[model samples]
Target: MKFGVVVFPGSNCDQDMHDALQNDLNKEVQMLWHKDKDLSNFTTDDCIVLPGGFSYGDYLRCGAIARFSPMMQSVIEFANKGGKVLGVCNGFQILCESHLLPGVLMMNAHRQFVCKNAFIKSADGTPLKIPVAHGDGRFQADEKLLDELQVNNQIIYTYCDKNGNITPEANPNGAARNIAGIRNKAGNVFGMMPHPERATSSLLGNVDGVEVFKFLGLN
Candidate 1:
């Protein structure tokens, strides 16, 4: 499948995502500028990616301003039509700000930026080591909404240990339920704090993250 990696003004990881898709995954991928309002070239079957970075220098809030980018309107429309949209790190913040996903990414409970390799486990019991870099990585929402997500099986990834154990010590940003990633009720939109692209290559020290792309049926 083709991939469109969004490039916001301060998006530092766009090229990394592009390279991973094109070189590692051998997929058709292009950089989509944030200011561009058109997404006519991308079909519903194609995947749109909002890569991680400090968009707008993290001025107002993480992803608060980037959500207003001209291209986001089209991204929203595309996702509403059952298109696949993946948001990584700051991109995940953008998705939450845009209401494409429930809950919000608040400041890390520890009041510090966290950058490290974290072990995360999918609901299906698959575990992977992915890198997470962010300051506002905590996820917060109403208790009812959290309950709804659990009942719907929308929670996709949670911080875990090598043994696939979800424990408080494994929680890097103090996210509720140790959530590292989640999908929308429809499952077409996904948002995650970890940088899967960076971990896809063995040259980077690990290829555990390749499982995420393969989960999308792209690998």
Candidate 2:
């Protein structure tokens, strides 16, 4: 399936996502600009990616301004119609800001921007090592909502040790329950703070993140 990488003015990782899809996965890709409103070329079978970056220079709040861009309206509509949407890092913030995903990404408990490789585990216990770079990567939500996400199995990834043990010490961002990623109830929309796109190539440190895209049918 084709992948569309949305590009906002301050987005720095759009090319990373594009290259990962086009070169590594050999999939058709499109660069969707923030000002553009049309997403007609994409369908339910395709994937729309909101790449990582400090959109609008992270002003107001992370993803707050970018959420109102013209193209987001189409992105939201596409997701509502069963299309797949993936948001990475700041993209994740945008999804939360847009209410496409439950919970907010608060500042790190350490009160500092963190940049490092983090180990996380999928719900199925798949181990992944991905890079995370953000100040507002902590996840927060009400206890009831967290329970609902857990009951619905919407939690996609959680911080874990190298051996796949889930523990608070492995949580880099102090996210609620050490959550690293999550999907919507329908499982069409996904969001994560880690930079899977940055870890997809073996030329980088590791290729473990490729499993995530493969899980999404990247082959």
Candidate 3:
């Protein structure tokens, strides 16, 4: 699969995401500047990746303003047509702000940007590299939407301890329903607050995050 990684002015994870998808997953991946409107001029087999970073200096919010980038306008159109989209960390924030996915990435309950090694229990049988990093990653959505998500099997991953119990402390950034990540109703689009690209190497201590990329056809 060919993956497109979007780069905003302040996106720090663009290179990391690009390299991970290219070298780690051994997939054809390209970097698109935020100002680029003609992604069609690049690769065709489509999969979109939104990487982590303090886009626009995290000024208004994690992804609040970055959603307006020219590339995003086409990203929304692509996703509506059943094209797959994966948003990690700040990318997840952009999805929420654009309503491409439900919920919001609010401030951590402690009102601070959180950065640390973190583990998220997978609900699916597939294996993956666990996620790490983030400060304003608490996930929030309406109760009705939450119920719908569960009923549809859209709640792909949840934050939990080694035992897999959803607890307040286990839920980093205090994401609502301990939702570490989720998929759209179509299951084509996925957004998570954790950085899967960062977890692809055992030398990094864990390879739990690689499954997400594999799931999207990278591996």
Candidate 4:
């Protein structure tokens, strides 16, 4: 599988994602700058990451402004064509802002940015790495969207404890419905708040996150 990690001005994890995919997972990967409007040059199969970071200094509410980037237009088109896209952290915000996924990220319900290694769950048979860190991580949408997510099995992850059961206190950003990760209606596009790339290898301290790639059959 070929992996393209999108890079925006303030995207700190762009290289980290690239290293994890190329070095750890041994997949073909490259960094696609946000300015590059042509992504058709790199579409082979299954995997492109919007990576985590404060794009554009988080000036207009996380990914609100990033949705208009030159490259995202092409990205939207790519995803619509059935390519898999993974949006982590701010990238998740971008997915929501781009309307590729449902809902919006709000400041943590606590009204503060949060950074911690929290546990989350996958209701399906897909096993995943369990821990990740981030701020601005809460997910919220209306009842209708929530209903739609459930009906379609698009809710891929939820905050939970080591036992794999969700806990109210574990809701780090007070995400509605404990939403931690989501997939597009087609199930090919995925976005989450966790940094799976950072946790993929033991040298980085844990291999739990490798399954995010594996779940997509990349690993």
Clashing pairs in 4: 129-208
- Per-candidate Cα lDDT values, in order, are 0.91, 0.91, 0.80, 0.82
Once fitted onto the true fold, the runs of candidate 2 whose alpha carbons sit more than 4 angstroms away are 217-219
For 1-219, candidate 2 gives per-residue lDDT tens digits of 888999998999999999988888788999999999999898899999999999999999999999999999999999999999999999999999999998999999999999999899877866788899999999999999999999999998999989889998999989999999999999899999998888878788688778878765544
Tens-place lDDT digits, model 1, residues 102-123? 9999999999999999999888
Model 2 CA RMSD to the hidden true structure, in angstroms: 1.0
Q: Which order, best to worst by lDDT?
A: 2, 1, 4, 3
The lDDT of model 2 is 0.91
> Where does model 4 exceed 4 Å of error?
125-131
lDDT score of residue 80 within candidate 1: 97
After aligning candidate 2 to the native by TM-score, how far in Å is the CA of 134 from where it should be? 0.9
| Global Cα RMSD, each model | 0.9, 1.0, 1.9, 1.7
Name model 3 segments beyond 4 Å from true. 41-45, 126-129, 216-218
Give me the runs in candidate 1 sitting further than 4 Å from their true place: none
Q: List the residue pairs that clash in candidate 1.
A: none
